[model samples]
Target chain A: MRIEEHPILDFKRGREIYFYYNGKKIKAYEGETIAAALYAAGIKTLSKSLRLHRPRGFFCGIGKCSSCLMKVDGIPNVRTCITMVREGMVVEDNDMELPDKEYEGCELRKKAVDVVVVGGGPAGMNAAIEASKYARTLLIDENPRLGGQLIKQTHKFFGSRRQRAGTRGIEIAKELEREVMERGVEVLLNTSVIGYYKRSHHFLAAADKINRIVYEIEAKKIIFATGAQENMLVFEGNDLPGVYGAGGVQTLMNVYGVKPGNVGLIIGAGNVGLILAYQLLQAGVGVACIVEAMPKIGGYFVHAAKIRRCGIPIYTRHSIKRAYGDGKVEGAIIGELDENWNFVEGSEKDIKCDFICLAVGLTPSIRLIAQTGAEISFINEAGGWVALHNEYMETTKEGIYVAGDLANIEEASTAMIEGKIAGLHAAHSIKPIDDFERKIKEYMEELEIFRQGYFGERPKKAKEKILEGYYEKMGERRSS
Target chain B: MKRWEREGVAEIEDIRLPTKEQLQKGVAIIECIQEIPCNPCVDACPFNAISMENINALPIVDFEKCVGCGKCIEVCPGLAIFVVKAKGEKATVMLPYEFIPLPKEGQMVKAINREGKEICEAVVKKVRKGKTPVVTIELPAEYAMEARHIKVKAEE
Candidate 1:
């Protein structure tokens, strides 16, 4: 099931190692996540669901989802997807395991940075790179690596020089990570930012999973590029072990080189779903069909065209009615959806499949920003609730800025552009730069050009509304 | 125009075809109809044959100065640029390819259209591999402007 070779990406060899899974020895490699090793070994049933006790596998391959949580080396609730494998590590499912013993409290540390950037994805990396030129910027990400989803994306980007068009995303991620490291941005990895305390000007509470050290940092300004979370479609047997997120499947197949499944069914036709379909075929996985509830395909036609030529069937106005299997997905039933978004009567058809993947949409991860008293509003067009920010991406709370999907759900190209804008703005707010206005204008012009395409029109309008709201609020504050 | 395009919901842009006069003059036909934010092709041309009024407008090809150098094909990231010329009964179509196990010179392959429909068999005349790989193939003059992709016969 492991992808020994790929056309685009080269998975170089690593030091061979061994780990114990339920007392059974399994071969692994150093620096590879425990979940990846298991998946490569064809162990998809990582854990079981909480109430129903149904088998659960890797979902959201990032640490955001707890589906891959397992007991590792006497530690409970270890995210196997994010946890690195070591020799002789004892791995067991932690879904039903009780605490064998209570460990001591996590170590604590305090420090201050000129600017602290949250969520080390494209947005955070750009923000850190820009802010570090003016101030001591500190970047923090939950994963051990700096690139968020960019690490998994192997497709070429779609924009001119400003968006790094023509460059594959995986290569771009490596370039960005190298630039961040070389530009002197202080990076803290394997640590998730959990809380923010504005009482002392700036307070960030970060928990490092590797060292079990909790960090408290005070900064003059901060940028939140925390990205978004995937959404699952509702259907019978949706929680089965074989059902996975579009990004989750990408991580399993692309990042770890593990085949997601022999046969699969994708639930959405958006860019995520469309891209996943093609990538699955590249990994030699047979996709039965893509079921989109919308009347038309939601992604770009060029993407759909590629899959069409590859002999994959896409069913528009259709929806997955149910997934049937003993414990994991064995087959699925799909039906057509009416205009009202309901399945039409007697339109159901059975499809022989082993995997059911969801690419419906994503919700912004706004827990920490909300904790900072940032004014967040629900905007469906912007992909659910996002933080309200000014043209400079400054949130309601002064000195705190929002960028990337945290501000609005978009892909890595625009997210990195927004990050550069917010980074420059936050840097100027912290310590004013002489070339601030020129840089902002240049970056904003490039951003405007990037948004001229049809796919970018909606996010462009949402940003206009956000700026208008900021100006209106500013006028009211001045009058008061 | 396609079905989804006629209904005004097409996400992919359609390419504007060149006139008969332009086709014979060795002018480039850029198959990018959308307002994408790309300007590499504009900068790639030394003759200034391609022009963009707006930063994100579809590139305009000047048939007189185009020269059919196919320089833009090397820089286009979307692999959307194609240069075609009709010479008697045969037509030379230069296309961008990125797949692995590339076709060699004098290789006979299936010529695919915009919709992935196989038009006919075409002979590979030249292969330019670099940051972008472009394969120039000679096909029937009737499929001069329609063939945009090459399918390796071995893959089938």
Candidate 2:
């Protein structure tokens, strides 16, 4: 288990690293990525699967899935769970794979473009639209369709009209896509950026088709609008067939219209967890319980009361002890934690549940960006090792800029603004700076306004963080 | 509707149409029928029964002195207002029912608790719907104290 009292997460933190697996000296951090530093050490299958005992690694370590887990430094089967890095952390790997099969390589692409945007989601589309103003922009998406996570979002957004308040997220996504199309931005759906490298003039993007192909394109700039993935949790028997990430539940029910199960237990009390619980009710599915390890619900009070007045009880300070199942998830065992963060003896209670949805937290997908030799920093506050970029969203490498979740971890609204900033800056680099200073000021002003609301306040801090460097530059310029 | 305050509920009390002497002069009638966020009932009436000037404020009803004339309840979301007319030994209550499974006249159904739980059985003597599907149910005067919610049974 993870540490119990982290400075940032406090009592919600897992246990301190104590035990070691397979005589390997692995350390767990107070709030670091268990899969990340472990991957750096080449230890996969942190734990065994429930039924088939298949080895699982750091597949979607953003807490989106329960694939990466281990009996951390003791405390059986914790999700090395997208936690922070700490000192003297000991983690062990279980369910080891046979040492015979050769590992397969990730697919790479052959076609080249001037500017390649990673995602076709809302931020990606907006970035492509803005970048197309000056540079030849090519938008690439792994999905067959365009609209990213917003397509599964059915609830109305809560912001001003400029941010499209009172409009459904999917509608806003559609509007953004149409706007991008109107700007004549080229879109390449079902295209994934397998790898990244720094060229003399630009960056080379490798993608996979039938076979891996390298795109040696001399691009003026690159924007990474690759959005976030869902988070997951781990417990005994958590890898059962019926268990899924919160986003997986969303994709299954909201997107595919296929019912995940009749009764469900949602672990995590953040906005995503609460929203999914509400959506499940709307879809005529029964919510068994909303379990959270925190003392209070993590989402807004309004969202909590909405579920409460509807008579759904939220259990706080409770964590899953075990998941009871055979080939599929049939039930789950949850227990109350004491002040020391230890599961109380005899406190375990079993509930008949077929589906367990975990919405713990998200980690930025920055492996490809890291592969390009960009300066990567492991910021605990900003998800994981994101590429370092300046106020213009450009990285240390001149032509390559990062946007959306791949750069810094933030929500969709802020990602949209960052994408616009990257796009505008990329365009400014390629074409004449047409009202560039004025546009930047206007964009920053609008972003400031959007940052004033309740949810926007968090990103406002992140914006200040990004702008701190720019503020010094401006001060120096004024002095000169 | 005007509201009347009475002490000690749960007992049958004699009620009848008020004589001309009891009718207040020029009581400004306020109809809150919009189901939107509005608080004209508190401000327009010059009375202190309403408190919510904030958005989405539910109008507070003062039972002691409201002249039952069907006003604020008409303007509530989901049409949740009722003017209880206690005459002789019978009480008539105006309610809002918007679901497809409508309750019919003389239908017997269980009254629900505040948490949507069933509490007591109530017989609907009459069923009436106005412009907004407002159903007025007439029940025995004794039931006026026990019944707060309503639910219909499936047809046999």
Candidate 3:
């Protein structure tokens, strides 16, 4: 089920290895995740739901979702999607059983830095690269490797030359990764920021899951570029094993060279869904069709055209009613929606697809920022409740900044620009730089230019509202 | 509703069709109608034939200045640009192709239109390989405007 040849990407698989999945031997690669290897072997069901005992597979491949949690090496609740496979590794479906072994003491390490940027995606990587120039920066991410979601993106990006437009996202990630390493930014991969405590100094409690150590990091400025997580569609049998997030499918096929399924029914017509349809076709997987609830296509017309020319149908004003299968996704029933947003009766059509990909939308990962007592507000256009930040990308809380999808659910180009603004601003606050004002202005201009398109209208309004709220809050605080 | 909006297949009227003289000299036909934030085609044109009011503006090609070098074909993230040239009865249509098993030179293939319908037979004329390979196919001059893609006979 592994894609042997792809036109856009060349998957460099590691040495051949094997792992035990439920007492059955599964062939794997050295660098692949347990979930990837299992999926390639056609084992869709990774774990069962705790309450309903329903079969569950990996959703968001970046370890944001808990569907792929499995028992690995006698430890329960290990995220199989992010956990790398080893030689002769033992991986079992989550049996809802706690580990019988006693908890061992983990090594505690203390570190101090000028800036701490969370999430090593496009935003955090750029932030680290810029911040490290003026201060000692520490970039932390929960993934086993850097680049966050960029590693799986094989399509070329859109924007001006400054944003690396026309270059594939994978290449942009590599360039940023190289810059981060060359800038002397201390990177902590496979480390999750567990908690943020406000004591005499700002302390971030991070746990390095792979190394089995806890890091207490104190920094002058903190940037939460924690990115976003895919939103789930509330359709019947959504908890089924084959219902995966769009990003998860990309990780399986593009990143790990594993086919998600024989045929897929994508549930959204946004850019992600459109790009995914083309990518799936490139990977030799059949796309049943794209079902969009919106009256008009949500993604760019060109993206939709790309798939349409390839003979893929896009059904607008339609939605998946339910997915049905015995243990996993076998197919899905879609129905046309009326003007009232209700499914028209007698318009249902059953699509024969082994998997359903949900690209509905994404919500910012605001947990760690919320933990910092930052002001959070519900901005529908901003992709749900996000931490309010000013033009400099600094949140309501002093010395703390937010960037990428955490600030707003926009494209990677905007996220990189925001990261640069936040990184330079944070570094300037730590130690004033001479050309800080000029650099920030240039980045802001680039960001404004990027947001002038029709697709940028909603995000533009949302950001203005957030800025208004930020200023209002600042004024109230000053008066009080 | 326009077919492009409903089905993502641009109609003949949606774009500026090349004149016979322009087609004779060859020109890059920009099918991009949406105003998204992209301007690589403008920069990709060494002749400065492609211009945009802003980064978000739709690309406008000056057929008079364009030499149909096909530089913009690979740079366009949307793969919406194509080069068409007339040669009496048969014409060449160059487009961006990213799929595996690229059609070999001189191979006869099925010429596909915007609606994914096979219109006529074409022969692979040339292929400029890159991250996003651009392939040129020769087909009937009448179908030059319709054929946006190619389906290799061996693929089927």
**Candidate DockQ scores, in order:** 0.33, 0.05, 0.82
Order the numbered candidates by lDDT, best leading: 3, 1, 2
Give DockQ: model 2. Answer: 0.05
Better of 2 and 3 by TM-score: 3
Q: lDDT tens string, model 1, B8-37?
A: 122323556666777875668776655656
Q: Could you tell me every candidate's TM-score relative to the true structure?
A: 0.91, 0.62, 0.98
lDDT of 3 by residue, A1-480 (tens): 999999988888999998899899988999999989988888888887778687788899888888899999888888899999999999987766766531357789999988999999999998999899999999999888899889988889999999999999999999999999988899999898989998766789998877889999998899999999999999899988899999999999998999998999999999999999999988989999999998788899999989988888999999999999989899999999999999999999999999999999999998899999999999999999999989998888998999999999999999999999999999988778998778888999999988988999999999999998999898753321
> Which candidate order results from sorting by TM-score in descending order?
3, 1, 2
RMSD in order of candidates: 3.1, 14.6, 1.7
* Per-residue alpha-carbon lDDT of candidate 1 for residues A38-143, written as tens digits (9 for 90 to 100): 9878788888878767788887888777888899988778889888899999998784556543235878999899899998889999999999988999999988
Docking class of 3: high
Worst 10 residues of 2 chain A by lDDT: A1-10
How far off is each candidate at the interface, as Cα RMSD in Å?
Answer: 3.9, 14.5, 0.8
Which whole-number lDDT from 0 to 100 does residue A371 have in model 1?
A: 89
**Quick one: best DockQ, which candidate?**
3
**How far out, in Å, is residue B138 in model 1?**
3.6
- In model 1, which runs have C-alpha deviations exceeding 4 angstroms? A95-106, A468-480, B1-14, B20-27, B67-71, B153-156
